[model samples]
Target: MTSARRTVHGTTIGIIVLDTAFERLPGDIAHAETWPFPVQFRVVRGVRPADVIEGDASLALAAFHEAIDDLVSLGARAITTSCGFLAAVQDELTRYSPVPFFASALLQIPLIERSLPAGRRVGLVVSDANALQERHFRNVGAEPGLPIAELPADGPIRANMRDNAQQVDRAAQERDALETVERLLAAHPDVGAIVLECANLPPYSDAIARRFGLPVYDIVTLVTWLHNALVPPRYRV
Candidate 1:
């Protein structure tokens, strides 16, 4: 076993990502790139939702394990996946590796839910509502019947947002996000916080928080929490 002292700051982090063709999506990968820490990442190419769920679940686990092992070989202390939808395999992935692993940003839901007051609720803003399940919410410790908003899944809008990167039309994304939040808040007026389920939504977090006048959580914030927890500066050698 690697001694605790040997594993301290010598640890790196690996991020397993899908092989999407889009180049401008500035999600967690971007955050990891600029993270002010000594971490490394390895992308496990060619893994997609359809292949993982329909082709073979074990294949997905195999790919995830392969990436984790590669990172571990390079001295990674922990692992994190790029997409929230991967939370389904959180348990299985962790079982195959000894290092600390975070399945998705939504993993912060349990903490967010606990911090809210009674009658108030936590809401999720995701790119695709159809892909989300009650299990995803439950895995994160959210109460059943929690409100959620799906951004316009239209191809053109998504394509435009992805292509622009940080230059993405703030007004457009905020309009869509705000419309969804407004609709949810109208129905569930007690919701006190909003969680951005899509990692790409962080660039617009401040606007969403300012417009809704509520706390907003996104992958950037969630990853920051994970970074602090698993790789604290004090832990660095």
Candidate 2:
């Protein structure tokens, strides 16, 4: 009788992607070239970006499970999502996934908090403040009322992204991101580090880091760190 074991290969990271038609640039986590190591991408069909961000996660949970199963079948050792808002579903997804699962970049908040001095908080830059909830923080071990700044939903950046416009106004998006960061700092001057809560924000990370001279954490940083653990480099004599 032939053995029924699953055949696994080289890919180490499995990215759970949203069902969106937007253009993903090089820095975007969903972009293949974004990572140095090989990765497998599984798009959770029917789970729109807003569905994860603005709606309850019960409906999207099944989509995540199905995607994770496909990625594992393709030999992914670890899993992560393309949206920080998915942190709301982190517990459920992690429970369903057999491999190590990091559902959102917001999972880095608690660790980043420890690095800051007393009374200094991590400032968050997210796609929408009104949509971010206590459950999103609780699932990721983050405290409720974490200082946050939301990108204007009515602005060109959100409009372009939400509509999946063919041409993204990079300059406009950058301006809005920067303005939000500035506002956050103005409100919370004790913010020691800034975290970009939206996966789409890493494209502007360097600019934000340069303008503020603070450590900026995003999905790229979180996933790269997770990838290192999932596939540590082999030492050759």
Candidate 3:
């Protein structure tokens, strides 16, 4: 007698969600309706935003592993997370996943670096500069010396994410984002493009791009590229 094997039929991507209670705008990865293709989501219950930003691997690794098992069993061709800050434990997650896993949008940093001209840089907008350390960059194979800016500590944007507020002020968030980008460009005038390190920021990507006149990269762009690779479209040429 042959043993039965479990399989998921159509889903190509699985997303491990953090235990958050904030409003997820359209472009944010946590919003299930954001993806065009069908996806499976498993909330790593108890894994909060602070845990992803500053907690030790031991705090979240077990939940991540369990989520990977669930997603893989469901036939997910690739796995990704809803939080970009999880880049801190990416190596551990990759070690546990049987399929391709993109733990953070920061994973695209190295590829972005390759596109830059000599002396030009990529500006990084993160949730908190204090939480993003040297190891986070190293985990994603990104070089050091990348200029970074953080969301204002006292702004509505940070309030929504860090405090897990029930409401988000889009107008206020855009104001803070635009101001931050301007400061970043002023400080690092040679920045060729901007990379948003927080997955929740993509909803405002266009606004930032219009204000700064630079390309913006975020989790949506990275995951879309990865999804294309996992399930390439067939064209009758």
Better of 1 and 2 by lDDT: 2
lDDT of 1: 0.68
Models, CA RMSD each: 4.3, 2.0, 1.8
Candidate 2 lDDT, 1-237, residue by residue in tens? 973356666788989889888787778888888888888888888888888777887687877888999988888888998999989888888899999999787989999999998998999998989988889899999998888999998877678779987777788888988999999999999999999988988988999999999999999999889887766789999
Q: Give the Å error, residue 102, model 1.
A: 1.0
- Checking candidate 2 for backbone clashes, the offending pairs are none
| Candidate order (lDDT) | 2, 3, 1
- TM-score versus the correct structure, for each prediction: 0.79, 0.94, 0.94
Model 3 agreement with the true structure over 14-51: per-residue lDDT tens digits: 99998988898888898877899988989998888887
Write down the worst ten-residue block by lDDT for model 3: 2-11
For model 1, residues 66-141, the per-residue Cα lDDT tens digits are 8988778777777776677776677778788888887777787788888999888788777677767766666666
Q: Kindly provide the TM-score of model 2 when superposed on the true structure, using C-alpha atoms.
A: 0.94
lDDT of 3: 0.87
